[model samples]
Target chain A: MNITVNWGLLAPILAIQLILMVTALTSLYKADATRGPKWMWVLIIVFGQILGPIIYFVVGRNDRS
Target chain B: MRQFGLFYRKEMLEMARSYKWIWVPMVFLLLGVMQPVTTYYMPEILKHAGNMPAGTIITMPTPTAGEVLAQTLNQFGTIGVLVLVLSMMGIVSGERQSGVTSLIFTKPVSFIAYMTAKWASMLTLTAAAFACGYAGACYYTIQLIGSLDVGTVIQAGLMYMLWFVFVISVLLLISAWLPNSAGVAFTTMAFIMLLSFGTSLLSRYLSWSPSRLSTIASEILTKVETLSSVGPVLWISLCSILICVMLAVYRMQSQESISAKA
Candidate 1:
């Protein structure tokens, strides 16, 4: 069970995921209105991994703003 | 031409404003990286599953670089297609609902120009994002798995992109026909899934279908001999895309007349 983890190979994947999450969260914060409640989106963005932000961007955010 | 340029610029600006410029490529990059990393880590993952009896040996063969790249394309075929479709589903329908289309049409803008402008911008964003993703996938696949022939990779990528172009054109056509964004997304996805499935099930008869582009793309990556037969599929795809754009323009024109009559 002692497989050595290579951070070099894993770092870029982690960074990209972080960037996606942060971008979605920032957009959600700045959005004037959303399809659903703000707190719910925050929870989804935090917990939803790769798909959470995509759903928020696609369906959650209201386009008027 | 001037109106087309103006609309293209505005669409690009809107893409940037909505953070699609950031997130879509990031999503692509993420999807691209996940394939190689997961493939490399599969053995370790199996070990960590913690269900095997002690000393139960598991042997997994390492996949070649071309195979890995082909798998990456498969990833894109599924989730990548869904993301692009969702991002673009509302492009026209949203505008129509919010009265933006009416505002633009009130000007001297031609329907063909408007539709082409939208098509061009969507294609641009898609190309940029896909290139970013595919580059990431290639870099990691070579670094971790093995080296691939650059020429084959590029050829495979272009073939895969034809599939994207066909899907985007379909999106534009559906968006023009439907006033509801949700309906547009649903119908477009259904159309894509049915076509892809049908094409594979009837490959002998449907070889010229644009859906065959994805299969040809993976074949090119795996070093299969497909080049001799790629012509008809390519030309048919290009023709289908042109027809989709024209039909969409005609549909929008008819909708405007209906509204005018009301």
Candidate 2:
């Protein structure tokens, strides 16, 4: 089972994930308030792949502030 | 019009500050590219799982580029719609609930202008996010699957975008009418799901339903349906969007008195 991985094919997915992560982190840092603890969101954004960052961006921020 | 411009600028600024501009398009781009990449890697993915019986031959036919693009649209139709709705659910109701609407209304703001500004910003955000998603999907599909006609993709994309606009308009109207963001999101999602399900169940009777926009868009890409067949439904959807905008304005005006009470 020596199938070589195609980095070319996987690059876009990685790039998108990186963008989502960075955006989530940036927003979390700037957010005056969040739905829950800031530390929890930081963990989610760092570990949650595509969905983690999205959830934080969508519902985590307390937009009222 | 000047007021609309100022309000739109404010909306855009808010979007930027909230990171909606960055994350929404990124999510769409991710959703777009995932379909083709996953489809391309399914065989490898299955093999690596190592749970299959020995000599389990997987002979899945590769899907055509058109099929892949259509599949991407299906992803957009479901999860993409959910993201858009959730992100925007609080646009009107949140403001109203938090007393921002009352503050704004105390000024010489035109309700119609305010609503139109909101509609414009929603359209801009949805359109840009969708374009990014579709473009990402197209790039991956063409690279991995096969080539597609650019004209066909544009036509299909336009049709699908109309459906998206309809969905956003519904959200805006619900947000304007409802008192809570959760209610706005839930009602909009329910209406969308019910409309699509009902159209499918009653296809013959509801051929002109806005829900058919998604199907027609995919059909255009698949080359199974002509554009002429889509005309009536497209017109119906455009009218529906117009009605939604008008209703949102009317609802917002009425909400003013309620906000006054609060």
Candidate 3:
């Protein structure tokens, strides 16, 4: 039984992943520092390399501290 | 518990004082009426527009009650809940931000009682606004596009209600951790979108996920999935709610709001 992976369709997946990760990390740094929890940052960085990270930056991160 | 009723009324008064209740329902009412009327007259509207160009064929399709309901749901369904959530996002966390948490905590109110009152009052307000809008839409839809099947209408109404609840629950959690409602609103939508996209990706492996709960009813209506086939989805929704509520309560306890708006 062969479970062949298609890197072609999966190529966009990598690009998508990269974008998600970068954004999440920036958001983690920038998100509401006073209120946002540590794990929330960690989870975004760890789980959402491109998507999660980007989301963290865009949605979760608040640098009002 | 004795103060819960009083607190509820007080909260209700705050809501009434704001007059947001009036505008929200009025906006939703307009949406409800316009959805069907627009859909009903769309072809005629398009036909008139086509006279300006190389004549495009305009086929007038009669608008059905189901379509009107769908249109109403599409235009303003998820949005109204988000508005309500954003408006009340500061309810719990705001006290902390304004340095009033300690003051409130020092009062006769326990965290559980106060939080419960806050949650309950907000939920009531949201329900009233949502029901008014949805009911108005449904009523006008019946008058305009004819009547929906009673069972179907009821089911759809319930499903729409749950959808709003789902949204509010998410925002409620975000609000607990975040000091401001705008952040909560953005975070809620962003979180939901991320969850949706990521869950869809992971659903290739995991048979059940929270995202499925969102799409299940609509899918069932469209014959894309069976009603009973969505049991796992319901279970997932239950689990998500349980986790979110627990986390939100914990966060509210720890959240030291410092008037820090980002």
Query: Largest DockQ belongs to which candidate?
Result: 1
**Model 3, span B143-255: residue lDDT tens:** 65687777766666666566566666777678787766567777887886677678667766544665555455444333344433556766767777767767776776655
Query: Which model, 2 or 3, shows the larger lDDT?
Result: 2
* C-alpha TM-scores of all predictions: 0.97, 0.96, 0.69
Docking class of 3: incorrect
Candidate 1 lDDT over residue span B1-262, tens digit each: 9989988999999999899999999999999988988898898899888778999989988989999999999999999999999999999999988999888777767888899999999999899889999999999999999899999999999999989999999999999998898999999999999999999888888989899999999998988876437889999999999999999999998898678667
In Å, residue B106's CA in model 1 sits off its true spot by: 1.8
Candidate ordering by lDDT (highest first): 1, 2, 3
Q: Summing lDDT over every window of 10 consecutive residues in candidate 1 chain B, give the lowest-scoring window.
A: B222-231
Q: Is candidate 1 or candidate 3 better by lDDT?
A: 1
- Clashes per candidate (backbone, < 3 Å): 0, 0, 13
Q: Model 2, range B122-160, lDDT digits (tens) per residue?
A: 899999999999999999999888899999999999999
In model 3, the runs with Cα more than 4 Å from the true position are A1-65, B50-52, B60-63, B196-214, B219-228, B256-262
What DockQ does each prediction reach against the true complex? 0.75, 0.73, 0.02
Q: Ten-residue segment with the worst summed lDDT in candidate 2 chain B?
A: B222-231
